[model samples]
Target: MSADDTDFLAQRFEAHRGHLRAVAHRMLGSAAEAEDAVQEAWFRVSRSDTDRVDNLGGWLTTVVGRVCLDMLRSRKSRAEEPLDSTPHGAPPSPAHAAPADPEQDALLADSVGAALLVVLDTLTPAERLAFVLHDLFAVPYEEVAAVVDRTPAAARQLASRARRRVRGADVPEDDRVRRRRHREIVDAFLAAARNGDFEGLLDVLDPDVVVRSEAGVTTGAAAVARGASAFGSAALTARPTPVSRHALVDGAVGVAVLVDGRVERALRFAFVRDRIAVIDIVTDPERVARLDIAPV
Candidate 1:
């Protein structure tokens, strides 16, 4: 291939760079490692003959996935500290080293992703790849099978098994029930916000609900509904990150708002009779600084 051909290929790869990084991030659970995997994928792509490849984006995604799979396997072989060597929501010990990246710390400390990543850490490399690709990325089982060296049917099964694990059946019987309930409320709130379902928001929220943030606190269902609506509007336009993660907020069931791979805010909930009564918004800077590991 000519120099022009290599330059053109590099440009094409750049178009898929963000997505490739996201894939690796979710797979490796470290932004730094994810970027390294993406860089490796670019090198591999540059060397390979893509004359027969139809979808350049899809091809690059598969390459990145394969690269990340290898990294995860290598980490496993090294028996490195589990990503959450600390408890899922535990604060770091002062005697230990602090995180290398504060924003990345927010990803785990303030987002549902922290607990989810802990669960993903338990899966085999092939299972993680199969699930992250097919389930998260919507890659076909046939394509995923190629990455994991399994049949399409087997790859689908791998994802299913991984999915069950991700959902936490192995958790203690008591903990599982509590997490399930938290998941329900958080899911409902997110759905309501995304769909502009005011009634739905009111349904789960107590009539005397209070939403407290650094900005100020809004009390009562009507006031709370209006505040949520404004937030929903901004989310729909500004970032479109209506996704919330179930996390242990200050030791209770809470949800965190994830935007562009960072935790924008976390809400610690106080429930009364199965209805959301108090929502303490764990805003960044303070939340990131403290871990608000403080119990409610």
Candidate 2:
């Protein structure tokens, strides 16, 4: 590519990095993977003869979409893990370790939530690419088909199937609403649990509340009690420690469960009115490293 062409490509890549990352992250469910996909797309775009392209933004989007789809398909064949294996219960990592740039942070904070990303993971690779490109990015079906290497009709079907999963009976509207109510319930749950107030815990918990740990490490309300009680007892027995700050996880309020300055857990809450609906406590250490947690 000529110097002018190189400069043009650089400008275009910078402009669309946020858009490309959003699409990739939605497909891959990991910020690290998404960044790699976008980098690969940029590599491809840099080598291509951009002078021949009529629309730069569209071309970049198509390349990023293709790269992300390839990653998704490769992941599916390699690992078949259940969804909801990890709950959103950990402190955010230090800001310097955050996987996304400032722009990406804003886009994710506003557009994608933790629950939505979980839903996207359930989709097949083709369906995920088609849905994200066509529905979320507003790419034309013809272009999306080209990126996914599918017939336009087939791509449409993939997107339709993915949409159905997102809008299915399993994902109730109430669950989405629960994201908004999660923070309040989490705060109340922690307070009551810390105080050993069984009545307080019962007041916040739904009659049939379920608390599942990462990879099914623990389950059910009783299990939740056992696990939480262990932590609470530690807090009471240990020397006075600084409290961790709380922040929104994909817009849902959550507590950053910290211990001795390192983020030990992230406790994301789900609520039905004033009652606790579900408490997802994510304890995946690798996943915890990606969040933007402020230091103690």
Candidate 3:
């Protein structure tokens, strides 16, 4: 390509940089690695003649997917085990350490939750690529097949396997253990609430924890602690004692309040650094009925 042509290609690549970066980050779970993959894609694309290329965006996405797949495979070969096997609260191994970057942090919080990232890390490179490209980004399985060097039907199966893992089906042993730990924390919180232990509630809650309910929003540990203690007292005095059971509310550790063996209320929790950072109380009968409550 001539200088002018090169410049034009650069501009086009810049136009798709944001989307490409998002794809790579979701695939590799590292901002730095994602940028490297995009750069590699540009190098490969720039050298090739694209005069016949009809869909520039689609072409670019496939090239980036290819680059990310190679990077993920490289990482996998060097690592001893899947990331999900890492014990909770343990420092990440070097192969898995993503630099602390604000942009990557924002990307994680916006695109995929931290928990989902952990699950994704357990997927094989081809599986991750198939799922991230076809399932998440809406790339056709045909394109995904070309990128992963698999038949279209085979590519679909890869994404299907990945989808089940990401959805908490066929989970790894350690991942199940992590979920158990999260349940333990929820159990502690519920126990504290039932006993009217103010300090106990605060122990598991983040200092700036926020609770949202049908009634209203409450912020801060002290405020939520007070509400929890009050709820506990009310539960004790109210007829047909309310029973709190640890259950999976929307695939996360949560508490379901049962009155006379029927779920009447649910508390969905979002954890930050193993502390309860947010609690969504679902009391609306319709909403509560819609929740996918399952035994943990």
Compared with the true structure, all predictions reach lDDT values of 0.69, 0.64, 0.76
Q: Tell me how many residue pairs clash in candidate 1.
A: 0
Clashing pairs in 1: none
- lDDT tens digits by residue: candidate 1, 170-247: 565544565576568767876787677889889889898887777787899887776676677463223564455667
TM-score of 1: 0.52
Residue 254, candidate 1: alpha-carbon lDDT: 73
Tens-digit lDDT string for candidate 2 (1-296): 66666666677677777767777776677767776777677667666777778888898889888887777777767773333212244222112133567665554534555666788878888888888787555587899989888899898888878766765536456555654455556666777677776666766776656675565644455556655555674532223564556764322356676668776766555544456656656667775674334321
What is the C-alpha lDDT profile of model 3 across 196-218, one tens digit per residue?
A: 99999999998989888777889
Best by TM-score: 1
The deviation in Å at residue 35 for candidate 1 is: 1.0
Q: Please name the candidate that would achieve the greatest lDDT relative to the true structure.
A: 3
